[model samples]
Target: MYGSQLWNITSLKVRMVYTQWRKADRQVLSVSYMTNCDLLPLIAYNMPLESILDCKYISFYKFIATSANKFVSYTAKSKIFDYTSTLSKNMAHLMHKYELDIYEIVSLSKYKVKDHSYYK
Candidate 1:
């Protein structure tokens, strides 16, 4: 399958490959897989290992990291509405540091509230 198709299938495989490469410390293997699978760009950004960071994928990493931070902040805010907004502030700082697009990272989605009148 093509890299794009594999990527769309599931992120689990990508994470697994990264984990293996990390445990083995095999840069060659990682590079080979990236090149052979045609996933050089997609895999470049999401690897959590600092040793694997490349200048070519810095922007992609920034996008992923910023979006993740925003997701965490949003989840925290939703679960604890009364709490102070420190999480969001921290996320904003990280986003700024990475020069990430805040609007692109913070996507709002509508959630449906389930009716429970029958239980009453």
Candidate 2:
């Protein structure tokens, strides 16, 4: 999953990757095909691969959100349509989920500015 940060988290393409990961993990663990695919060695109900990929995306966003390069910074705020509209994890929503607001990001930081005036 190299460069997975650039991939759409909710895209169908990602589903394909996930399927492959599940299959590969089962093979590695030598488990029966019927074995629960979502379980980890000691951590049940958590998909570490998915979690890692998500963290990568978040780390990339943080880097670009405060980046000095204009184009790079713009990418932190760019919108991308999901290849599969059925899923809804777009970058903006992801940022909001992780408390990375566009206002704070565009202002070149992660701390929210409080008691600020907003002109209509």
Candidate 3:
């Protein structure tokens, strides 16, 4: 069940990033390349599954923290839909449960995708 949840979360991250990339004015090739770079280590790493799960979750949280506000605002203004506060509360609860500080998670999430070839 845990493995399945991890996979779902990872898939969510990929979908989210791809959606953003498509909407971005940046070069598609460059964005695709960068996304691949960010994802390859997670695909190839040999770390314990639990560690990988945590890393992915932290990365997702960082992504949400950085990007969700703009999206939430736009949707709220245009569609009268607003879920950002609820999402933030849920994230905070998860962070507390995991004993993870937001700043630390954001910092460490950046390096989680580095080469893990030595683990192979």
Find the candidate with the highest TM-score and give its number.
2
lDDT of 3 at 97: 51
**Sorted by TM-score, highest first, which candidate order results?**
2, 3, 1
Query: In model 2, where is the ten-residue run with the lowest total lDDT?
Result: 111-120
Question: Which regions of candidate 1 fall more than 4 Å away from where they truly are?
Answer: 1-10, 26-99, 102-120
Residue-wise lDDT of candidate 1 within 33-91, one digit each (tens)? 33533243245533333212222122232334445588854564453233345334434
| Higher-scoring candidate on TM-score, 2 or 3 | 2
lDDT string for model 2 (51-117, tens) is: 5665555555667766899887665445334323311255555555556554553453322222111
TM-score of 3: 0.35
TM-scores of all models?
0.23, 0.60, 0.35
lDDT of 3 by residue, 1-120 (tens): 243323433245645754564434235333343454444334444443434544555555556555668985444333212334533443454456566565555555356432221232
**Model 2 stretches with alpha carbons more than 4 Å out:** 41-47, 78-89, 93-120
lDDT values, one for every candidate: 0.36, 0.55, 0.45
